[model samples]
Target: MTVTDFDFICQILRQRSGLVLGNDKAYLLESRLLPVARKYKLASFEDLVRLIRVKSDEAVIKDVVEAMTTNESFFFRDTKPFDQFKQIVLPTLMAARPNKQIRIWSAAASSGQECYSLAMILSEMAAQLSGWKIEILGTDLSTEILDRAREGIYSQFEAQRGLPINLLVKYFTQVGDRWQINQKIRSMVQYKEFNLLNDPRSLGKFDVVFCRNVLIYFDQPTKAKILNNIAGLMPNDGYLFLGGAETVLGITDKFQLLAGQRGVYGLTTGQAAPATKPAAPGALRA
Candidate 1:
């Protein structure tokens, strides 16, 4: 593809999904969008861009944007966040909220693994959360992945990564060569199609949010906007989990690193009214 074609595609991605593509990413565009070009029976990437130029379709834009959006995720990705969540965050929150209700958002939840991981951890504390209300919301921009997440199935290799053997055995039943998260864990979470670039207020507020590993794609301004919107929906004492490589430092002041915790953040001050009970699972689908 010519530089002009590459730049056009990059512009389209940025407009559609807030992905910032640099001039050096020509190879990446070819690697990811070539198959999309072929799928539409276009002769080459140039032809794909030509089609978009002449007759832009919303579906085509969506396909190209989703094709470029990174959906890398796995169960308990990066051990420290889950450890902090299970060990300190949950305990402190439980003590503070005697109502015994918890709501968590797995932002950019690629395929529900992270959400289910949270469920399993909570389930392990079932005796303590026996009468409590718990809801896990898993949202992603890709409809296809959200569908897969709802199905609760994973390949052996996918399950092996970050999923401990004992927990895997307890929570998943082998189906032929693949593993499926048990219905009990699956029922505790719900999936929805969401975009971080859009306003997030409609999704309702969350006490614990897992918006991990997704902000690095955006430019600094876009990143700041997204972090502010995320903060807008969290209570003062709420917790936010970002990827280890991502941080709030030099980004936004809405959150600060939780005291004595790594990869965990808390609101700086002020509290939103706690979210009411979440609707039954499947009701929040986009």
Candidate 2:
């Protein structure tokens, strides 16, 4: 593709999704959107861009955006966060608000593995949380991924990644060569197509928010804006889990690192709560 075509496509992606695409990422655009181009019978990437520029078609635009948005995820993809969630965060929340309902938001919940992982944890602790109401909301920017998330099926390899043998046996049923998460676990979570850059306050407040591995895509200002927006939708003591490589430091003062809880952040003082350091990567098993 020409420089002009690449620049135009990159601009559209950033405007719509807050994804920063440097000049070096030409290969990414080509690889990811090639299917969209071919499906539309466009002769080349240039043809795709030409059609996009002229028609500004909603379907075409949506396809392009979804294709470009990264959806890489796995069951309990990173270990520490889930460990902190089950051992500390969940218990703390339960004790802090006994007899109250609890909600979790997996903001970048691609394909639902993260949300389902959470469901499995909650299910394991069902006896402890018996009388309380709980729900997991998995939101993504791609409707295509959300649809698959709702289906809750995984390939054999997908089922194995970061998933323990016992839990797998208990929670999934084999269908042909794939595994389908049981209805009991699937029922605990809801999937929605949502954009983080947009206002999410209408969804109501959450007790914990998992926006892991998502903010790395945005520029600083956009990152802070999204962080502040998330803060607005969480309670004063709500928990936030970022990716292993992500942190609220140097980004926003809205959240403080929870003491001794690696990858787990809480509200700061006054508007927020105290936060501790996160654990080292790969410290906890899934």
Candidate 3:
């Protein structure tokens, strides 16, 4: 691809998905978009670029953006975050929420592992949250991945990643060589296609947000904008979990690191809650 073609694609990705692609990633564009070109019956990569530039086809653009975005995820990735969710976030939210309801959002929820992992944790604590309404919403920019997440199927390798033996036995059933999460666990979460660059207020308030491992690809200003928009969707005492490599420091003042917690954050004092909290959609009664 020429310099013009590479820059154009990078700009579209950044604008649509808040992803920052450097000049070094030209190889990535070629590798990831080549299949997209073949799928569309385009003759060559240049044809794909021409289709994008001249026709400005929305479908092609969407595919290009989704293709470039990474969807790397695994069950209970990085044990500490899930541990913190179970031990800290849950207990605090349970005590504070008088309605016995909690909503969780898994941003960039690739293939639904993160959402199901949380569902399994809630299922294990069913006795404690017997009558509570718990909702888990998993959102990704790619509709294709969200479909896979809703299906809740995983390869043997996927099922084994950070998934404990007992929980695996308890929650999944083997189908051929792959595993599918039980319907009960699958029903506990909902998946939707969402972009971080857009406003999140429409999704309603979330008690906890697991936006782990997503911001490393964006520039500082994009990171700050996304963080602020997320802050708008959270209550003052709400919890935010970022990737181990990501942080809110210097990005935005809307949130502050939770004391003694490495990757957890809470809204700053000056951050104001929405006038009225909207009810979360598709809540499951536990």
Candidate 4:
């Protein structure tokens, strides 16, 4: 693609998805979008760019954006965030929520592993949460991935990634070579198509949010804007879990790190910290 075409594609991604692509990733345009071009029967990448520029087909634009957005996810990815949820967040919320209801959001929840991981945890504690109402909403920019997430099926390789052997055996049934999460676990979560660039107030309030491994893709100002928007969707005392490499420090003050917690943060103007202690560090891979 030409320089002008490259810049135009960058603008479309930033405006639609808040993703900021630099010149260093210029090579990705062809590697990723070429298949999209061929899928639409375009002659070449140049022709695809011209179609987007001249005719501006919304379908093509949507596919282009979805194609570029990274959807890398795995069961209980990175371990610590799920540990925090099970050990600290859930117990605290159980005590504080008078109505016995908890709502959670997994933003950019690629293929639903993260939210489902939380569901599995909740299922393990079913006796304690017998009378509670729990809602887990997993939203992503890609409709295609959200469909996969809703199906709750995974290949053997995906099933094994960071998922414990006992939980896998208990919660999943082998469908041919792929494993499908049980109906009870799948029904505990919902999926939606959402863009982080847009407001989240319509999704309603959440007690806990897992917007992990997503902010690192945007620029500084976009990062701050998205963080502030997320803060609005959460209560003063709600918890936010980011990727191990991401932080609210220097980016936004709406949240502050929990003392001794690695990837967990609570609202700055919220209530006191939870009484639970930090979990011991260990690898949780299967």
After superposition on all CA atoms, what RMSD does each candidate show versus the true structure?
Answer: 6.6, 2.5, 6.2, 1.7
Best candidate according to TM-score: 4
Q: Write the per-residue lDDT of candidate 4 for residues 122-170, one digit (tens) a residue.
A: 8888899999999999999899999999999999999999889988999
Per-model TM-score on C-alpha atoms: 0.92, 0.94, 0.93, 0.96
lDDT of 1 by residue, 201-277 (tens): 99998989998998889999988999999999987889899998899889999988876566788888944223333
Candidate 2: worst 10 consecutive residues by lDDT?
A: 270-279
Q: What is the lDDT of residue 285 in candidate 3?
A: 16
All candidates in order of TM-score, best leading:
4, 2, 3, 1
| Candidate 3 per-residue C-alpha lDDT over 106-142 given as tens digits, one digit per residue, 9 for 90 to 100 | 9999899899989998998999999999999999999
After superposition, the stretches of candidate 1 with alpha carbons farther than 4 Å from their true spots are: 270-286
> Which structure is stronger by TM-score: 2 or 3?
2
TM-score of 2: 0.94
User: Residue 139, candidate 2: how far off, in angstroms?
Assistant: 0.3
Candidate 1 residue 23 C-alpha distance from true site, Å = 1.7
Q: Scored by CA lDDT, what does every candidate get?
A: 0.85, 0.87, 0.87, 0.89
The model with the greatest lDDT is 4
Task: Tell me the TM-score of model 1.
Answer: 0.92
